[model samples]
Target: MQTNDAFSFLMAWAAAPFRIGSVTPSSATLSALMTKEVGPDTGPVLELGPGTGPFTRALIEKGVRENDLTLIEADSDFAAMLTKRFPAARIFEMDATGLRHMALYNGPVLGAAISGLPFRLISPRRTRLILEGVFANLRPGASLYQFTLGLRCPIDQTLLDQLDLRATRIGHTLLNFPPATVYRISRIPVTKSYDWRYA
Candidate 1:
């Protein structure tokens, strides 16, 4: 990571530790783990809270075209920086929870989403809104990759059940500051109901 990036991250963290989540940018190891399952084939990608664009860089390296990226960042400075760094990407300087109301695309066209949001600090209700908004724009079988510093999944089980979603631990990296674990959050597959009378 660049020194300026680290300084900017530290400043952001100092302003609102809970909102920023970490005092430094994610390490390359963690970035790789978070994006390991996504590639060019993933189609248009969505990224939430892309501070300093570490994971965003990894996505491009994984062959996801710059134009295929839609970044949602609340911080003004970070949003401005991202625009300059990724001119081809669609950078939206707005709260991610508002995604459900916004028409980011014509429909559920996003194939995957990677999140750097601080879920552990957010309230369950707000978390639900964020998840609902994100999943609203994701195609079936698509997933949202989220990383947390907590030992367990940051999203509670009740909320997952409420949304008919599931979380699976994909990987973790100690190389990252304070360490972090990546979870793949996807909608549970729906099975057709059986009809004994027909049989």
Candidate 2:
């Protein structure tokens, strides 16, 4: 596919009703961020809002089995597009917050969530809710991959503390527009509370 075609697809989705605010096509850096950290996608990998599936495609190309991919996309149009693009992968038309209610695979899931959702623009309550659901659904040692143009992800420290999620900078993508940083946050035992990371 031409670069413009792929670029247009991502731009259109980000501008759609869902308000997924990516200013550019997902960068190569964004796609590579988690693959290097997830280290061998041997189990089920859940991708949220896989708009055009940049990360999904990367994961598949890196050795993840087609059947082990479960994508949760909120946009019906995008979900339908993903279904066509990746017939071997499972697609769910649900929001991230509803993850706890869904049926998951029986085997151990790879504790990595590749999030392309626009967390910086979303409300704190909504963000926290989704993180909580992710925490509950994923086993310990599972990590969340999030990238943002801002120096830090907009999630508040209190929210992170409440969910016991700890943040570690995986790397940065200076090639992206406005540049961006990637973080791999995992759940850890917390003895003290912290103020909101956003605050």
Best by TM-score: 1
- Tell me the lDDT of model 1 at 78: 96
Question: In model 2, where do residues sit more than 4 Å from their true spots?
Answer: 1-18, 190-199
RMSD for all candidates, in order, please: 0.6, 6.5
Backbone clash total, candidate 2 = 7
lDDT of 1: 0.96
| lDDT values, one for every candidate | 0.96, 0.74
Q: Over the stretch 133-192, how does candidate 2's per-residue lDDT look in tens digits?
A: 666656657777877777886577888887777888878877766587887878886466
**lDDT tens digits, residues 1-199, model 1?**
9999999999999998989989999999999999999998999999999999999999999999999999999999999999999999999999888997987899999999999999999999989999999999999999999999966999999999999999999998899998999999999999999999999
Which candidate wins on lDDT? 1
RMSD of 1: 0.6
- Model 1 CA deviation exceeding 4 Å by range: none
Give the CA lDDT, 0 to 100, for residue 31 in model 2: 81
